[model samples]
Every structure is written in structure tokens, then in C-alpha cells.
Target: MLKSMRENVKSLKWVLWLVVAAFVVSIFFIWGASGKLTGDDAGNTLAVIGRKKISGDDYLQALRNRIEAIKSQYQEIDRAFIEQLNLPQQVLEQLVEQTLLVEQARAMRLRASDEELRDRITSIPGLQQNGKFVGYEMYKRVLQYNHINLSEFEHSLRQDIVLDKMIRLLTAGLAVTPDEVWSDYQKASDSAGIDLLILETSKVSLDEAPSAAEVQAFFEARKGAYLIPEKREGLAVFLKAEDLKKEIELSEKDIENYYQANLSRFTNPESVRVGRIWLPFEGKDKALVEAEGRRVLERLGAGGDFAALARELSKDAKASGGGDYGFYDWQSLPQPERDEIHRLTSGQTSDLIAEADGLAVIRVTEKTAATTTPLAGASAQIRSILLDEKARQLADTRIAKIEKEAKSARSLETALRKAGLKGESTGLLKNGEAWSDNDPSGAVGTALFGLKEKEVSAPVYTYTGVGLVELRKVEAPRPAAFEEVKADVETALVNERKMETSRARLAALGRRLEEKNWEDIAARNGFEFKTVEAHKRDQYIAIVGESKTADDLAFTLPLNEASAPFDFETGTAVLRVRDRKTVTREEFENVKETQTAQILNQKKNMFLQAYLAKLKQEKGIQIKYDKFLQLTQDVLSRYESAKQ
Candidate 1:
């Protein structure tokens, strides 16, 4: 019975299956080995959770899998973005959380049966076709495509199922009460009308500038802020692959070899230019919606203009634009939709297709048959590829030879001169600054800063090519003279004075609330009065800026009452609530189920977070951040090398 049910259930979509594969493979890479320390003198442990130590090989492989996953999403992934996300620390933290949960699951004696694991694998949509499992060979092919081992994938799947079962046990019976549901409904449905007055700092003027003594004092107090940054002077010899492309020559054999190796790249998939007319149900009876869809299709079949009919009767957002969905590859659409579309010839319309939310009619305006480029037709592209390959090889050889000579010579400049290459001087650069205007990659600067005076660096790869750098000089930061920054100090003091004046005026306006009309006060104080109508908590109030402080105050203040001055980026706002509305009982009842589900989910998430935190605290989970970072650097080095 379980196998039959699993076979009937739809498998996970391909994209989701790939994500699961990546995550599962990463876990195996972290803990798949014999659970023993190996190789490293400092021990191969990357982290320890409870009684288990996560090995370096596991962590490195996990990191590599993560990089590959990221690369799939982003075409131009870089080190800076990776560092910004602090991915290594994030991955380690996730592993630690998983370990805590798995340990707790084991303590509770929770386990997943082999049948359950098999059922789960068979249920994935990516491994199924035509409502049936695609057999073991196909399943293995899917795993191979995702770079996952069959045994390891099954092991991770078993662990995931166990963890899920444990989580379900922990969160079972969680519910939302009537009061909680009512409170959530009110918050979601409430809206406020507000009157606002804004004060702009730019409009406020100061009477006097700061004296020389005051300016000097300000500079003295913040002298470190004005210090000159340290600078470096260096010479770099660069070799670019593209520059060497003109020197290298490609033959017919090379072109044919490239073409034969990458035939898939030269093949074009079949595509259809498609247009759609969507009729949304919009709470209508399903039978009525289907009838309306059929009526539209009949009209289209009987010489009705698709665009005109769509503009007149279609409820889709793109109705006015003729409901044109444009060109699409066959594989890009859902299987059902693709099957329907494929049966139609160009300029033919399909019947009313019942979809999840509504009904759709598809029209194929044009079709392009799939074709593969012949060797003669693909010669130009292949030649370009071979040329690039040859250029890179030659450039790499040249850079290696240059690096060897630079290492043996007294100076990089001497080596470059001997090799008939001219080295460019960067003149001066700050520690964190680029070595040259053209060196935006910062590889040269990074290499130069790490070197001592007169020291040369190994070849560093940049966007342009490879670079060899020599450190010529280093100048440490020093405090600047007061006179040099006197103007800057004056400007700062003036802005501070203006801000004080603006605040005083705003406060005085706040104090006169009861006696004066807000509109009259705005006229008297040179502030503009604006009204915001029926805005919810999350909605942006244009008059009061995008800040939520005004929104919160509007809801909290009594109707027909003014709020204290709220400060935002543009300036300060004084707000008054004009009206407020709460959700009606009938309205709340209509969405009670949805609200309950949302609240229950929120409670579950909170409980899970707190559970993880408590488990970490109880287990005394200790992380060596330095070790994680070093491991990350080593993994990134390997990733970069693999890419090259």
C-alpha cells in the first residue's frame, strides 16, 4: 500500500530536486567518511558538535558543493560577495544546528524505515515520467546529473526523513486561539487616515559660521578621521590572454576537434512563438468559469481576432497588451501545457485548458524546428574557441616563465627588462586602495600590501590577465594640519547649527498643538500639510516618508489627536490621526482558516528556533571561527584552481 501511494504521489519538481541533491550531498561530504580524523598535523577536524567531530574533507566538499550551487544561480559570482555573506560561517552554523537536531532525534529513538526512504526517493517528480517511476537506471542517471552518489544520497535522505519526523513530533498539536486569530485579523485589516507636516533641514538657515578656534578644536577632537591613508608604490608586469590571441594560430584540425567535443552547444532546441488568453475564476463557480473559457475558445476558432477578443473579455493583467506570452522552448513549459501546445500547428488555437487558478487558451503563432549546426557552418565559432584556448595556454606559459625569472632576479623590474617587457609604476596607492586606476580587480593592491619593502610577489590573476608585482615603498598614515581641513570643519559646524534650529522649531510646533489648527500652524511655520488615506501598517506613507514610525504612531494615537514629532531621513514629521477602522466579524470569519494557518506556522518557526538555541546552549557547541575561515580560504583556492 505504501509503495502504491508513493508511486501515485507526484515527485518533487526538477529545480527543487536539484536543491535537495545539493544540500544532501553537502551533508554527506561533511560526515560521509569513517568518522575518523586523518592527514592534517593539527587534526582534520573543522568543528565539533556534542560527541561528533565534523572532518575537514567533509567541510571542504560541502563548501565546494555550495559554491557550485551559487555558481548555477549567478553568472559573475566573486570573492567579495561570498565574503559579504560569510558563507563558511553560515554553512558551519547550519551543520551545527542539524547535528543538534539529529542528536536529539536519536535520543528520542526516532528512526526512518528503509521502505520510507525508498518511498521518498520514488516520489520525486524529477525522477518520474508519465505518472510512473522511470526505473533504477533513470534514477541513477538523475543522481549522477546532480553529482550525488546513490548510497550517500539514500543515507542523507534517511537522515532528513528522521529529522522531519522529529520536528513534526515536536510541533504537533500546535494551534491558534480565537483571541490570537482575532488580533491577527485586526492588524492585517486595519487602516488609518493621517494628516502630516514635514520640516526640511535644507530650508532651515544658520546665522553664523564657526570661528577659527572652534574649527581647530573640532579638527583636534577628531584628528584621526583626517589622517592620511598609508600609500604604496609598485611596478607590475602583466600578461593578458586576449592580447596573445593574435599571435597564436588555429588550424582546421583544431576547429573540428572543438566542434566534435561540444556538439550539444551547437544544437538548437525547438521553439514556438506562443500567445495566451487567461480567464481568472475570481471566486466564480468553476463550471461557469470553464464555460466562459470555452466560449472564448469557440470565438477564437470562428475567425475572431485573438488580441481583440483578449482585450475585450480577458481578465488577465496583460489583456490590454493582446495576451502575448512570446517565444518559449518546449522544455521550459509544464509537461501538460507543453503537450497541448505541441499538438497545435502554427496559427492554430488549443481548447480551454483548466489550470490551478483559472482556464487558459494557447495559440502557437510560429514554430522553429530544432537543428544542429554542420561542421562547415560552425567553423567560425570553433575557430574562435580554439584561438582563445591557444592564447590562454601561451599566456600561462609566458607568465610562469616570467614568474620564475622574477623569483631568481634581484628585482621584478630587472627581470621584466631582461624579458623585453616594460613594467608600469603605480606611483602611490593607499593600503586598501587599488594599485592603479585600471586595476579595479584589486589583485595587484592585495599582492603589493602583503609584501615587505623591495619584495616581489607571485603572479596574481586579474580580469585583464596575470600580474607580477614589486613593492617599491610604503608610507604610513599621519595626521593632517588643521588649516588644511578648516573648510570641512566649518561645513560640519554649520550643519549641526541648522539641525538644532530645525529641532527647536519643530518642538515649539509640538507644544502649540491644542490651541492652533495644524493647517494654520503649517502656514505659520513654512511646513506643508498633506493627508494620507486608508494606509495599512506596512503601506508606505508618502507624506511622512517611507519610515514606519509615523505608521505605528498613527495607529496608536487616538482619533482626532496629534502625535509627537517623528524623525526620518528627509526630516521630522508631526502627524494627526483622522480616522481608523478595524476588521468586521464577518470579514474575520471569511479568512479565519488562512489566518490560523499563518499564526500556527509562525509559532512553529519560533519554537524551532528556540529549541535549537536551547540545544546549542545545553551541548556547549564551540566553534573555532579562525579554523573555519582558513578552511574556507583553502576551499576557495581549490575552487578557483578548478575554474582555471
Candidate 2:
């Protein structure tokens, strides 16, 4: 799931990149988080050191526009690179960090006015053709086409400027010293040597056990390494628009009123009444399922119950319900389903229907006459519709109130009563079917997962439109108490015992071999003793790369020497190191470029982490990391809900 999320993040980034690239691409879905354009769109802001809202919409669009620019520059651009260029996370992080830095600059009384923002944007080397700032008309046109206005556009461009300034200062002192680089280079080329005397601990296990003192000491030494988790106390309230609709009481009078006022929404559509028959095929011969559909179709054509035939032969979800799908119009069934139905009349059943999953059988149950529904006729439905609308409005208002109430309540019981709702509590639960999709009580186990002792949840909408809910409390996560984890702990102990037994046996073998040699030990142990050739680091069977085993162990052996058997966690193995050698200069140079690039990247990343840490400290840049993460979560949650 985490891997998929990473991929999704990558995909989001690319989406921005693609939009930035082609002027021809009209993007609305991304700006709406995979939906049509919406109101909860994001915003952007630039500050000299104060809080300002940034537009999510502007940020997403600029991200898309950046891709367009890249594509225009490189005609052969691919989807992968565009995705890397458009990380929403990177954009958000950049937005927050830049906001912080700019705020710092502002706190010190820094000011970049309208003129500076414009000059900065236009002065971009990529944007300018002739030295002078690009024409505002051209800039305005691009921004307009990308679904943004002047101010939002300026906000993003200014953020880029603040980032450039802050980064330059923070990273100003970093350099790759010649001495350090040379030392790294020499180490990369060097080989380490070491020797070992194997003592196989696994060869013994009497659970003749550790003395009580030893066991107690082992547990005590590791006591502080374990811990409990932090729990939260919070309040939340959700106003589901759907739930609000349920309480809406629409009277006949109200329906009539609504129909009179909004007459268009109630008008009936041109519709077809239909039924079906299904058939299956097996090679060139008659297939069982299709044969059934054929038999039913034949019976229908020769005067039979269409619904009965459908019930017997149609392979559809509606088959058991006598294939009765209520009235449908042009917009009701998609074009394909509608077309098939449109081909039939009230008494007609469709021909042997051939579909990949199975053959289909269709018969028109009844044809709906084309007519305009009068307001009077649609009054009841209109009332229900209007009632739902009213209910939703009420639900929203009450939900907001309830959420506010929860925030200050001393307990869930108090909050629920005040909200005019009910609450239920449950013991700790693992995320599972009963606590997830199939949760019986529903409220306590569904929706956002992390929970603590007295936190409320955002409103969760029940599919039945019963109501929205909030989880009021949860217990903190902790190491399982002794009894709770007894089974697992026992399994671990048993495995340890088995390993000890094996290690002791190996230790005895090693001792005998050191005193007598491999032949006598192998003869008595009923195993073969063999030597492997001196192999390259990359050719090892057990360890990978230039690890301590490959580095220290492999290079230390004298030519043609037999080492004692070693105990690995899973088993015991003995090695006879035949030779030790270094990589020739020619061989090392062959892969030098790739190796150097990896080394540089590793170093750069380490430096960046330290640099950012220093900046946070030396500049006294204090952050409520938890609160900040909360803000990010708040924005994300709001964003997800708006799309829904």
C-alpha cells in the first residue's frame, strides 16, 4: 500500500509536469484532485514574513505549466521525467519552507513589492528572449490559459524567488574539499583485512536455561529501549450533506411548491421498457449457458412470459428479479445498453445475445410513451428531492455545531448528548474486517485509522444514509502486555533454543577441526568438507557488496588456508579462503564513473540533511513539527473531502 502511495505521488507530480508542458492540454481534473473544477481549490501566497494562504489551484496549474515549458524546450521529453518534475509533495514542501523563509525575511523587515515580483518573474533567463522583461501580455495570456489569474500567478513566481534566495544562503558554505574527496577515493579503493575464530553458540541448548539472574539482567538492560505511545485528546464533528437530507420533511405542499418553482428537473425523459435473453457458446457446438438463452428466446417468440424467460435465461444481476429493470431514458442506460434496448418494443425479445462473459437475452418488458411530465404529476418526487436538500442543509449546520461542541466537551457522552446524537464505545481493536468494512457497530471502527484516548473523528457517512459519526476516543499503541504477546514471544524463544543447540554442535566440530583437521571432523559428522575459489565481492553466495563479511572476512585469509566453521543465524558454514587479492587499476577504472556518481549523491544527501538541520538551529527556526504535520494533514483531509 505504501509503495502504491509512492507511485501515486509520482503520478501526481507527472500530471503537473504534463500540464506545464503543452498549451494544448486543458487540465481540470488535477486541479480538482481527479475531478471536475471545484470551489475548495488550492491557493498560493508570498510573504516577507507573515502568514498568507496559497491557492492549491494555482500551485497545481503552475506545476502543469512548468511541464509545458520543459516539453517545449525538449521535444523528445517522456512521461517519466515530467512526473519527477511535478511532485506535489515537493511543491507543498517548497511552498511551506519558502513561506517560512520569506516570513523570516519579512520579520527582519524585508520587502519585495509588486515591481520586484514582476521584475523577478520576467528576469528569468528561460522566460526572456532579448534581455528585457518579457511582455506582460504574453505572460498574462499564458496564465489565463492555464486557469489562473494575475495575482495567483505572481504569488507562485515570487515563491520561487524567495526559495532561490534562502537556499543560496543556507547552502553557501558547502564545498567538496579536495582532501576529503581524495580520502573518500582512497577508501573506495582500499581493502580491509581481519581474522576470526568461530565459536558456535547454537551447538548447545539445555534450556538447562540461563540462571535466573542472567535472564533478569538481560530483561533489565533492555527495559529502557521499549516504550509506550502518545495518545491524543481531540474533538471533531462532520456535517455530511447526505445525512442532512434524511431529516428533511417534505410535505405534499412542499413538493408542489418545489415542482412549481423548479419545473425542469422533474420532467420525464423518453424511455424504453425492455427484457433480455442470454446465450453461451462452446467452440462451434451449442454451449450450455447460451443454449439456455436460446431456448428461452425461442419460448418468448412463441408466446411465453418475457420476465419468466429472462429469470430463467438472462445472466445479469437482475435475472433473479425477473430481469425487471425499471424505467430508463437516454441518459439512464449508457449508449450500448440503451441501443440494445432501443432495438426492441414492448412485446419483442432480443436475438441470441452474444457477450464475452456470457450470451445475453433482452426483451422489452414495456415501452414508455414519450410525454412531458406535468408539475402536478411529479409533485411527490419533487417534494422528496426538496426534502433531501433541506435535510442536507440541516445536517451540515448541526454537524458543524456538533464538531464545535466536541472540541470543548469533557467526554464523548457529554458531546453526543449536546449534539443531539448518540455515541457508542468499544475496546481496543486491530484493523480487520470486523473493525473495517464489515464493522458491525459501524462508527467505532471505520474511516481514518489512527486513534487515541479521547479524540473525535471527522464525520463519516453511512451508506444507508443513516447518519454521520465521529470516533470519540482510542487507546495508545504499546508493546503487547506479557499475556497478549505470549504466543509470539514463546515462538521466538523456541527458535533461539534451536539455534543455540545448532551453534554448540558447530562449536564442537570447530574445536575438533582446529586440533585434528577437516577430514577427521567431516568423517565423524557425516558431512563433506570443501574449499571455494577466491571470488570477487559481487560473487559471494551469502553476503552482498563490500560488506564487513566481504570486506573484513574475505580479504584476510592466507592462501589455501582452512577456517573453522562459522555460525550464521539460519545455519552453520565453514569456508577455506584460497586466496586474497585487490582489484587491478584497469578493473577499477572500468566502473569508476558509476561508482563516483553514487558516492557523490550519497555525500550530497548527507550534506543537505545536515545543512537543513543547521539552518533550523542557527537561524533559530523553531517549528512545531507535530502541528505543522497536522496542518498538512488538515489540508489533505479537506482536499480529499472536497473532491468526494
After superposing all C-alphas onto the true structure, candidate 2 shows an RMSD in angstroms of: 18.1
Model 2 C-alpha lDDT per residue in residues 1-644, reported as the tens digit of each score: 33533333322322223334331232221222222212242222211112244444434543544443443454244434544564444544444444455555555454456787767756644344345644565455445544555564455455445545555555566555544544455455544332223323333446565544554454455444444443222233334445566556666777677656655444434555565444445453557666666677677768888777667656666678777665532222223445677777776666764543356666676676556557766655555445544654465456556656765773545777875767543334434213333234444344425444455554444322223234444556675444444444454455566666655555565445444255566556654444334454433343222333433456566644545455555444555554455656666667666666666667756875665555445544322222232223222321221111
> What are the lDDT scores of the predictions, listed in order?
0.71, 0.48
The best candidate in terms of TM-score: 1
> lDDT value for candidate 2?
0.48
In model 2, the worst 10-residue window by lDDT is: 635-644
- Against the hidden reference, what TM-scores do the models get? 0.54, 0.40
**Residues 362-424, model 1: lDDT tens digits:** 788887777887999888766755665566557667777877888788588778888899999
